[model samples]
Target: MAEGISSDYAVIELWKAVKSIKKDAQDVSVIEGNIPKVAEMVMEYILKNINYFVPINNNLVRPKTYPIDNDPMSVNWLFVLHTLNFSLWYPKGTKQWKVDGKKGYFGLCNAIRRAIEDGKPIWNPEYYTKMTKSELECILQSDDGEPEIPLIDERLRILHEVGEVLLQKYKGTFMECLKLSEYDADKLMKLLSMNSSHIGTK
Candidate 1:
């Protein structure tokens, strides 16, 4: 789907890469003796939590603190959320960034929700395409006395980059891309991989 790389080729390459790494790695080794035990444990866990594995069941349940729902806006919100999801981990001994008393990924979600509640059209490509560093700082600000979110400038740049892509090519909404993909997960993935720089193929 990405130019010369077909889906099948990508899968084959991924498998070969993993195998090569496992063969050459000095620091990590597979425990063949533990395979059966680990398999049993995994199977037991899957059996015990099979209900949670139902796609519809989990899709119906989401934290209220997330600014998402069963709509196109939710798709765009998820796009924005994942675009800024990285580098949340702070250095050892540093104060964790927080929002609405939550830390890490939850903190990011709460910040986006708070921004929407405060009338910031954060999910809209038009707004984020031109968003300033100062505005993003305010949106992702942490609790009092805590360090700021890590990689704040990188996040801002990524938002602007992806926002411009959406605005220029996808009609300012990811829904257009989804429609073009006809709701096919593989097609959508390929579409994103081909069009967006930050949305990695893996």
Candidate 2:
């Protein structure tokens, strides 16, 4: 970023370059191959140079979620990893943790909202990549140590708690609705037989 330039401008310029190249590239794999180079540029301009104002958690404005390191590959490789992870959620067989919680940030946002709205019970833990609180703290804790990878278990636990809080508010009503909607074919058949006096006597 320039001394006086804004993050929005920096991101726009970066995306223009990234998209132009991506438009002609064969596949995301090719983009993946070049990620390190893009990552280097992002580091140089955004992470290392860091002068502009960057915001987090703003709902009113469009989020420009470039990595804090400004590593374009942070954004790039992230997309590839997230897409692959989410695809694993709908399983063909056993839903091992590998794909069970593989939702992107938006997906997690929706899941949390649904859990809250539907009065669903505790959120089932899945991997929350960006919201890895422990990992973030570990990164802060280190001065020279390698950045700590997040504990997937702890992350899931947090989601479960959050889900529980949301669901508790409406759990009774939601469960009642669930029970009422459940089918009882035999009981329905018995009632129908008893009420069929005028039905097809011929």
Candidate 3:
């Protein structure tokens, strides 16, 4: 079994924390009257789209533009993707960084795909641990005249930090971490939160 608190208790603790904060929260308040309406709306929508909610559905799969596959490397690829997923929102009126005409998150996805196509082993901790700013620039380069990806330096630092952790603690592959979590999603989340500074538990 995974160590530390159980996932059920973790959720209960989170609920308690949120409730405590909500009591004193001035800027935000949950309207209890809207709960049933919201729940009904959600249920109606889900029921209306029940066909898409099946176990075998591929509608929720990642886009084809992403550099992922049915392999352990995809886990590390996702790790890298989410590590740099933040700070994508840019101020209005500014030129957005794009890859293959896709902006923001999809742009980042395409950039990773493009990098992999160019023979860059971006999913490998060994490769990313030594990745330099210039290399990342090339990987995430935008269309001509477009602005560079935001927070490149911070993203690079996070990548280096996570890559080192993967190498030193998780055998350079996220698969090992997954194994340690026994394929439990909650355990995996806690493991990532405990191990990586960039990924914290809410």
Model 2, 72-135: lDDT tens digits are: 2242223222322222122223222211132333333333334334543222212222335553
Q: Tell me the deviation in Å of residue 134 in model 2.
A: 32
Predicted candidate 3 versus true structure: per-residue lDDT over 20-108, tens digit per residue: 88899989999999999999999999899888786334434466665435765788888788888876645545566788987767788
Model 3 spans with C-alpha error above 4 angstroms: 1-30, 33-51, 54-61, 67-69, 197-202
User: In candidate 3, which residue pairs clash?
Assistant: none
Highest-lDDT candidate: 1
Two-way TM-score contest, 2 vs 3, winner: 3
lDDT values of the candidates?
0.80, 0.36, 0.79
> Which one wins on TM-score?
3
> Clashes per prediction?
0, 0, 0
For model 2, what is the error of residue 46's alpha carbon versus the real structure, in angstroms, after optimal superposition?
A: 1.4
Which prediction has more favorable TM-score, 1 or 3? 3
Clashing pairs in 1: none
Q: How many backbone clashes does candidate 1 have?
A: 0
RMSD vs true structure, all candidates? 10.0, 23.6, 10.3
After TM-score superposition, the amount by which residue 69's alpha carbon in candidate 2 deviates from its true location, in angstroms, is: 19
